[model samples]
Target: MKTKYWTIVVLALLTAMMSVAPASAKPVTVKGKVTAKEDGSVIIGCSVLIKGTRNGTLTDTDGKYAISANTGDTLVFSYIGCITQEKTVKSAKLNVVLQESPEALKESMVTGYTVGESVEDVSSEEIRIMYVPVRQELPSEEYNEIVENGFMKVKDTPLSTFSIDVDAAAYGNMRRYLNKGQLPPADAVRTEELINYFSYDYAKPTGDAPVKITTEVGACPWNPVHRLVRIGLKAREIPTENLPVSNLVFLIDVSGSMYGAERLDLVKSSLKLLVNNLRDKDRVAIVVYSGAAGERLPSTSGSDKQKIKDAIDELEAGGSTAGGAGIELAYKIARKNFVPGGNNRIILCTDGDFNVGISSGKALEKLIEKERETGVFLTVLGYGMGNYKDGKMQVLAEKGNGNHAYIDNLQEANRVLVNEFGATMHTVAKDVKLQVEFNPAQVQAYRLIGYESRLLQDEDFNNDAKDAGEMGAGHTVTAFYEVIPAGVESDYAGKVDELKYQKPEKTVPVSLSKELLTVKLRYKQPDGDSSKRIEITLADDKANKVSVDFHFASAVAMFGQLLRDSDYKGTATYDKIISLAKTGLGKDAKGYKREFIRLVEIAKGLDKE
Candidate 1:
């Protein structure tokens, strides 16, 4: 009887305890922000994952993230260049600050061009350029050439001169910042690059000329009273079978700064894709640099794809960046294996962190300029970020007569190296310049939408000695100009006092008055010394008939202006941009246009925030 009573009492006590016990700790929605400990700046794209679970999410542009977790469950936060942290979930809100990884700090010292186990053993000369952030201060080392293209009066400045720019690094880099829920800096928003990033349906070159010029004039979307003129250069597209034999030098950066998986590892993967596109007639050489420069592979036949890929796979990151030395070595190798009447180029992959010998921008430019005289083209592929030297890379690409592309992910790599192989590697024209003569009778003042760094003096257009931009096979370059008609009034366009010393010019002929502008393009053959000129006359009647491409291009230009907060933007609102972009989203075969719409929406939200 006593035992039965005790068992009943124990069962009753256990049931009471079980009834009061929490039910598996009901899932609670946890929200938090991840920021850099150094500066308290929100870290966009920081990874936040539930510990021991597959559920994870990235921080938005504002460094905010949300996850569902149970009491006592842990959450892990990780970011590149920062230490990973784990926190126990006790409340619905938990914020985190990630510190710079100690391991990364210790690995800053470079012993040689090879990966070292310890930084303490590294010598002074072996040290490469690395981001050494001070405690409580994470300095941004990003570079951008400021863009300041002001308004030009037609009577004072009749000729608009600029180099043709096809480099799309700024667009990709801008996408990076936006996708991470942040707005790109003003300097990073290169208006010309953003305009040229997409393909426009323009007529192909049908004549012996390597490129054809296409011009469009349409009502400006931002200010209907004003007008926008677009000049497009379309290079002839050559079939892959007709491409000449290519001699390529892969100049890779393997410095300590490139230690992350996104840096060296992604580069190896990217190169492997390019290797697959090679032919037996193609020859490739591998050059890697850190504290020093070394040749990893000799000029080997592209038929040996496995060998080339293996060499790339074996690459390890460490040491200091010797970008100048590496460029010299790569060019030397390219010259040694120089193929006449064939494609000869050096593809430099780096973060633009040139620390060692000959690291100055001027020195690098001079080196590349001299080597370009040997008929070797340069292709600069920028990788990694957070201390990326965009200005240096731009100079290298400009002076070396090469294209600049920033590869943020594998998809971009595939686009640049594989999908657009011919356009990316094959040159159609070089030293290309555009000069537009606006009719003073039809226009009062004008402002170029972009291409600040590419602007040239009027004399440079006819000067064969002046260096301009290179056009690749099948590449398209576009430029936008905002014009104020003679009758329209704009606060941005300041009127200049009439020149008392010089008499007022006579009125243009009625026939010429009807013409909006004449676009003159000067370009040289890939291996030619002299430039060939092409003139395109745009009429007022033609300006009234615009295509989807014109509207789309105008939308992109307006977006850039809004992003840069340009004084000439007039009334470019995000909603207005979205509506305008939607109407012209023709074909959008690659969905890049649609993607751009989404980006605008994201920007809209971020702007509100």
Candidate 2:
């Protein structure tokens, strides 16, 4: 009854406007001002374009931008990190509101490559270069003319959104932030330890079989929310048979904040484990970070296991963390023992809880930005969990020309070690990225979920030095995206009124283009310093539901939706995910099938609360 009443009210308003004009007529005047930042203090200069077409308008002196868009046109408002808004302008006067880009606050880190840092930090001596290959939304052109020219205008109200994904790699090389249900205070956190938590699964040296390793991107299919990413390391991984001698450095964070068993103990235990796994051919060094920084161990060989183990066992955690000091000390150690090519690397172990000195973006960016030129690659291992600064860890890794991961326990330790050796130790591909160009004819209004921080600008592509994600030899990463089919309508989140946009577009079903999206990959040999390339294209078949990529990816998406409690989920539920996964258990080669089923039971139990 209420819905019907609202619809009647909407139609009545439309009728009144029609009386002032014609039935099949032009757009009615709808005006609104756009204010920038808080209280509209700053006039924002931005582009107002329709979703698909390139037609748009630029903000004027007052940060006020205007564009004529009709009942069905999806208006896209964009400016840096400010959320890109999309709307279907009904009665035209849209006093658009442009909020400040959250990234605008402290977005100086791109990958681990912090600002004021050298571009080379995005790459390495072996990597040569790195770039954050990205794609930004384009403005709509044709639709704007229709509204401005008064060709198409619907009297009905429409839907709109002021949402845009933050380019995580852009500001701080972060793909994921610490999923805090609630925010944590600074003084209680240790920034350096947070920066180094992920277990990177380092492989032992072998003769050189080009060791293969693997890890799952997320949880067992059973419990989709708890995605499990396994890292496998092996012997002879990243063989030094022909490589230069590496001047290795270890940077550990011993802040007063890292006084817990999970923080300090985890670091010592993980380091001890990694030390035991080292080969006689490798050299090692250690540095620590607190309110101040210090070097615990100088360049030493793997052959002197006792020397390294003794130093590791002698370490203790106390004092506030000075991130800049730790980074500087580590870089200095690497430079002092600078090796021409063997394998210069600084392994950072912390919880990423920097709060004391040099914690700001401009400050840290300038510090790490200048350190990469010496050819020392960085590897960040994050420890602990609560109040974890996952973002900061990713920044250092990205800028340090490395990768980031979170370490919770020993099983995770084994996963990083025994399972993904090549990816952990060898660099099979550098700056690998994914770009999907959706076919509008096949789908409508696509939204990429999660990776909210990974969205990249279009220009970032083609630049070799841009820092993207890293891929180890034989490593597989899975990403899932859910798309709404064209013509599908829902009362919630509808873009336009009536079928105005769908009318001339295609009321009759189109053939549905076969090639849904393309996947392009570029890589470099772990031993070779130059880069190479590879590409694979994915087609949407909508067939063979028995078992397929869509099925798997969809399951993953459903799991994500369930976890995030997204609006897009329909009948999709935890049981449904289990049912689907069980149906397409595939090879079940590793018996992960059984494990998944059990996890489903576990997740169901957790939901009772």
Candidate 3:
């Protein structure tokens, strides 16, 4: 009887200990690749989450992901436009194949029209026989007019000055047009943005200066008689771990116009990518605007990523847009939680449609300009297709001492928010302006390829009070000048009557120098009030063999001119552009260059129509 009682007591103690013990199924590292079921193409930026938990990760560029999960825990794989899938984690390696959602398929269908018959040609009686896809009425899209730059006589205007622009909204916006089998409006193609969209292998800054300059001259691809000069500036790169703590406000527009998968939906996904990359030291607040502006999420630690993402996911589109009110509230929040000497920025995501108060571009500009004085920079992210207000977004970004980008797809989001995180969020230099002084001895007449909107008074370069563009860490700025060599009898270099009241000024001794041009740059440190200046001289010698970047940039410039139907695009053909891009397609690890070639081909077909 004693032995029985002791055994029973021991069993009871063992059962109690077992009930108090931790779970036996320890979390193991699970690795897998995510791909599409239809074509088996790898899907990038897919979210892999452990069921019933906040633990999740995004797939890398190769569609590979690793996550910790228990043996019986469920793993959920999801991506925009793909159906969500769940699988039990039976083993360490579990690959996932997601199917395209039916909604996505419907949205992806392109409108088809019967060939060889114009809508006017079809009679009412025969209209039923014509095959035409049903589509919604076209929305009125607005784009500011772009007047191409004209050649200036070096003797008359010796110095060409402009603010440096790192925005690449034009490139992605242009790509959207071509992808839809249509040509972009002439005013929509910004040449400099197209060239700067791709990364270049320029030398990094080695000194105290945040930017380094590289200059090269080569024979113009379109007009061989004219020389092409490339000026490249590479900003110092800061590693992700070394970046400053951030105080970010996500100012999102949730207006009635944003009610679509491509507008608000895309904005949410893009912000999530950014949220996933945030460090624990950073903080984020979300401000949304519809009929009224309100703060959906207060300033929260970056460690609470799930909370931030939940706020983003809960957003829905409705009512009118109170953009000005939203901006005011966002700035207020940013200033209230201001992190001294840290990166404080507001990221505005919208279709740029503002129907309520302070909707005009000038008003928005003024409001942002005032808010910018509080040491908070702005980053404008334009989204959606129809009714996109590019003009207003441009003014806000330019006046707010910030940068602008257009997010057209998930891949673009990955590129801007993930791959180029440092360059997209951290500003190392602000108020950067460039001035080029042409030498009459080496060049007769020259025209800046683009940047008509960024032209600055020659005096503005020396004025520290003037506002200019900001450069982010790891950002690269590229500009091109098409030069009419001295003695070239071109109509572009038309003779100007000698000044009636003044005799020709004596040529300076520097004109005798072999330099083609002097490039001067001015920029202020992120938090500094005063500006610093740097100058570099480009020799007259033309490069016998230009680098791959130079060739690719020239191709992009020619393509832009062609798209815009500029008066200066001499002998530029789509075939020539494609060939040049092919020659310059170095490594192309990201495949952006190859995509450029494909876009050129698509444009060629659309141009014929």
Candidate 4:
């Protein structure tokens, strides 16, 4: 009887203890902001990860982030150029400030043209210790000349025709120069690219069309006497889950010139970010070049992200650049693993320093042009600064029906590879050309703001065979035209000598219409060879108020002109650009426009020096 009573008492005690035990700690939402310790500026694209887990998120434009974590769990915060931090999830909120890492800063040393350098006498350890930061301009950097477009009389040149350009490399490259406390070369300042680098609030296509067009006319901030016409095209946006399968070929330049942290190292990190975003349906192949071309990674399923990342991490920079060979190998791999009616692209990451066979711009253009016809599109991602061949990159991208971008930092890499993935990887429209017919009655003279190299013959607008630019999913292209209204006398509208042998042609009756201009666009489906045309006529709607985008884009254009010291930059000053930019700083959620404002200030200071 005593044993039975004790057993019952023990059971009761055990049951009571079980009932009193606490449940597993429920996960709580942890949120915080990350900033730089030096300037207290919010750090964009910072990576936040939960310890011992694959769960991670990047900070938004405002440097704010949220993630679920259990009590006592550890959180890791990391970013390029900043020291990594860790904190225990003791509360629902934990802010982090990362100090600049000295080691990371030292890795940014500019080593100019290390190709074919004899290092046999120096040991690897000695070389490491001797590698120090050199802050001198590299004379080997190259740029194509850009001549400003002159105003043409509307009567003589009613049609302004050009291929649409989506490349923003010039803007980023210019920013690199400014960040180094120097003005970018005039040839590096492409006005249209600078204006189009920032996103604008344009309407997406509602119908089967892949692109939508928006137009606005406003008084030019630089020259109040002239009107600025803004033409914008917005590609349709597709959700991440709904995107087509992607067959990507990563063409990496492992040449000696790309040995710096800002070059090959940045490329690896950038590509790793891309790998993280890949879907199971997507496949990737890596082709690298240094003196020769070779496949580093075969076509692997995106599910094997770690394997792909490992391949990228193993790449080392050395030897002469065999860029053409890399291109050939990449395209071959892309074609071998082509996804029909899907995204098939070769992403060429390089500093554009090609010294081996088929290196000239014309020869590279021909090679890429021939390869591009195989239904494989190209994307040129430039890296590094000294010995950068911007001209070669531009030619390859332009001829290959591809876009170009310069990745100056890891934040820029995140912007291109993570935030704008679809727009950077997938194509919606190809061979996009625009022709604007101005009404002689409403406009006396007009000139295209930029696109000096993109000018197409008027007949090329309707020619389906002529290659032009490609617009990616959710991509936005903007063009600005300075218009001198009828009867407005300006120096830009120069007097021309009359031809005695030529007789004046009769004006069309349609010139009397109230329309200011008619914009016609022609583009082809991603997989189609034929082209389709869209036309829209803009009337002189004086009631339409100028949008914030107009002001912001104009400010960028003015800044570009100032950088170039263009003759047409009338009354444009850094102060004026800043004030105009502030007025247009609407809902800058990503803080890109805010960053632009800061860049303008930097440029102003550099100009004074």
Alpha-carbon deviation at 149 in model 4, angstroms: 1.0
The residue-by-residue lDDT of candidate 4 on 91-199, one tens digit each, is: 8889999897745432222222211111111111100011211245757899999999988889888999999999999988877776666788999888888987888
Using all chains and alpha carbons, the TM-scores for the candidates as numbered come to: 0.78, 0.56, 0.81, 0.81
lDDT by residue for model 3 (1-609), tens: 999999999999999987876555667889899888898877765667777875666665457788777888888776645677899887889999989774432222233221121111111110000011212333687889998999999988989999999999999888777767678899889999999898899999988999999999989999998899999999999998899999999999999999765678678877877887889999999999998999999999999989998898899999999999999999999999999999999999998999898788888888998999999999999988878888889889999988899887666777788788889889999999999999988889999999999999999999999999988999999999999988888999987687899999866636576789999999999999999999999886665478998889999999999999999999999999999998899887766787688778778988898
Superposition error at 100 for model 2 (Å): 55
Tens-digit lDDT track for model 1 on 330-403? Answer: 99999999999889999999889899999998888889889999999999998776777888998899998889
Q: What are the runs in model 1 whose C-alpha is more than 4 Å off?
A: 1-138, 498-512, 542-544
* lDDT of model 2 at position 429: 45
TM-score winner between 2 and 3, please give it.
3
Q: What is the full ranking by lDDT, best candidate first? A: 3, 4, 1, 2
RMSD list, candidates in order: 12.7, 26.8, 15.5, 15.0
lDDT against the true structure, each candidate: 0.80, 0.48, 0.84, 0.83
Per-residue lDDT tens digits for candidate 2, residues 7-90, read 999999999987976344455433455655566543333446667765554443344445554565666655533565676767
Best by lDDT: 3
| Candidate 2 structure lDDT | 0.48
